[model samples]
Target: MSPGPRLPRRTLLKASAALALPWLLGRCGLPENEEGLRLDPDGILDLPEGFRYRILERRGDRMSDGFRVPGQPDGMGCFAGPPGSNTLVLMRNHELEPGQDSLSPYTQDQGRPAQAYRPADNSPGGVSRVVVDATSFERVSSNLVLVGSSRNCAGGASPWGWLTCEESVTEGHGYVFLCDPLADSLQDAVRIPALGKMNHEAAVVDPTSFIAYLTEDRSDGCFYRFVPESPGERLGLESRGRLQALRIEAEPRRDMNAGVEPGATFRADWVDLPRPGAEDDSLRAQGAARGAALFRRGEGLFFHEGSVYFCATTGGPESGGQIWRYTPEGLQGGMLQLLAQSRDRGVLDMPDNLCVAPWGDVVMAEDGADPRWPDEHLRILTPSGQVKNLARNAMGGGELAGVCLSPDGRALFVNMQGDGMTLVITGPFQQYTGTGL
Candidate 1:
């Protein structure tokens, strides 16, 4: 395979034009100022162009409730509610194994999910809902939504209007649960098993169809789709339907045995994942078994305009992280196509949570193990596949997980698991008309 495109210094200079103009004009304007800020083509945090970043909420900031921000916060979504009352829901994935670092929100009230029915000690997982002051851009009311799981990773919002945070694994009660933001019933967290049980990372639901798409977070992780046979069934209740995985029948030997990098383009023939609670011993090989061959080490998935977008956390000798686009109208009538692969472009050093901007732009969060990438960072790629950094960890280099744009497209809510605080990026983020945002 051909080597992916490299990020050259000249291209970086071209991409930085928006930031360079103000710096150049400052020399000629009033007093000599070295700092002047402006919005770049890449969707970075908007500030006073000249004024530098001021960290508002750090890892150990004390909250009004006396509970501090927890361990590395991951996948989060920002919803635009009433004026001055924006709700920011975050999934703080406690990336703990059997024995590792302790999870966050140290107090008793902060320890468990807002409601935990299937309880367990020494293991707790959940999400936090924080109110963001739209005008002042402050962190307001934040609380836990789920609890008592492990390695909770990136999840997605449902067609039914609740956030589904996926547990990276499914041992114990590490299952996918629906979080009804408006529910005041105080019901214990409800886990949806029809979605299949494994190492899950995120979920994408088709509002029109209510079919929930899911991604697994392991190297052998499987990609699944829970198709509600009813298509309009209510959540929580199990529906009669099938969970199918993608199997490459034509190139089983090549695809099953081809342990190198995937083909230049991603093309998967759909197969079926056995219904959960079935016999584990299979009759076929790993490659020919019922599964999703779209990509290995799957991480995040989002659905848009009849197409599914996903990211592969790892796979390949050199191409560890990649983003693949699967459109139903492909070779198999309903197949997966590699519309764009970060490995092909050398952009995604390590990609995690994903979201689509209002303008059809794909925003990816970087969850790199090694600090930050020189050119690879939280990025925005256009439909044409041109990629640019939206935000780099020049300020902080933690695995940037769970990224979502506000419904109004005003701000981008991001999580740096290692950083511990759900950072909100909004300011004079205006498009600046002619000035830029």
Candidate 2:
């Protein structure tokens, strides 16, 4: 099938305006240089004055490949479209576990794909690809690109494709899988076991070193990286590599959950692990026993400007959240800094997925730990250690996931996980984000 035609810029604007009207007044009490988030009348996402959003895709929506869009959309990575095409491709994860057939990518008649991993168990977790026009921001096409993984959570964009992580340690389930953003059909579920196999949350390949940094979703999880004997071997990450965990050079087994203050830096180094694909879930334990530093719960991971930034949900003094930065000195040594930590749940809670915006600041999606207050938000952490509100889940309650941006930096894409909605937010992004982070 052919891709959708791109809509004219004026036409797209007119259509968007008809869907969402301007908020005459109100402010989020933001910084003087930033605009306040206007309450969304649609009660979905509240954005700043000039920003508007388009619901690009949702659960149960039929795709170009005949399969239905799965629910629980989690992590996402944006890629430049094929060759000279004026579009961006989104490789998005659906975090469905077994027995979620109702929210699976397939219908009763459709069933699981022949290439699905763990077909008997019918694990309904995978990644989908969506093409959007760069100018209009309308979806050109959508399809399932990877299937049969469990709890496909947050992942990072790599030069070759998307590094989707499965946040599950069930039998034969937890591993990172690569998905091509440009593939129009379901691809084979090839697991990169060398990346490790225990509650994998996210993975990001360093463009400079081609070494992949990974995050685990355990309370005692260890930050890991897989160094391929040969960099840029493409998808051959599982082929002859050393899987290692991060260790504090000065302090061994430093527990980050004790709450490290923002801006505190430490010398960091990597310690090689015994077996990344061990039958039991002992990878973190092995690393911990070997003097590797421990994080609360590693979630989203992003590499920007020579530094790797990752979120630790349920971390910090109050177990609110923590964001850490690992700046690689070489491939083996680096400096680890506590970039930000939430002391109050009301301000910034359980930062899950994050990406460095084109103009600099880090955009974060909160998976709030407070069950009493279900409101989650999308926040921006500036380079100077200031955290500001950017958007909120006006849709009642749902953790914002898959926070990413178009290559041209014109649109920001994120997923309302519980609501299973993918939104494209467009506005004067650069005007508010050039501060650098």
RMSD of each: 8.7, 9.4
**lDDT digits (tens) for residues 1-437 of candidate 1:** 12122343322110111110121111111101112333433333323342233333555555445655556577665555444444543334444433433545456555544455444544545555555666555666554555555666777777554545555443454467776554322346677767666666787787776767777666555566666778777667465666656554455323321343222334456555544533231212232354435355677777766777788766543444665555554323355444333333234566778887665666778666543343335666544334544555544455777777666666667765665646666533334211232
TM-score of each: 0.74, 0.90
After TM-score superposition, the amount by which residue 47's alpha carbon in candidate 2 deviates from its true location, in angstroms, is 0.7
Best by TM-score: 2
281-335 in candidate 2: lDDT tens per residue?
8999989988999998999999887888898998888788887878888766988
Runs of candidate 2 with Cα error greater than 4 angstroms are 1-35, 433-437
Q: Once all C-alphas are superposed, what RMSD does model 2 give against the true structure?
A: 9.4
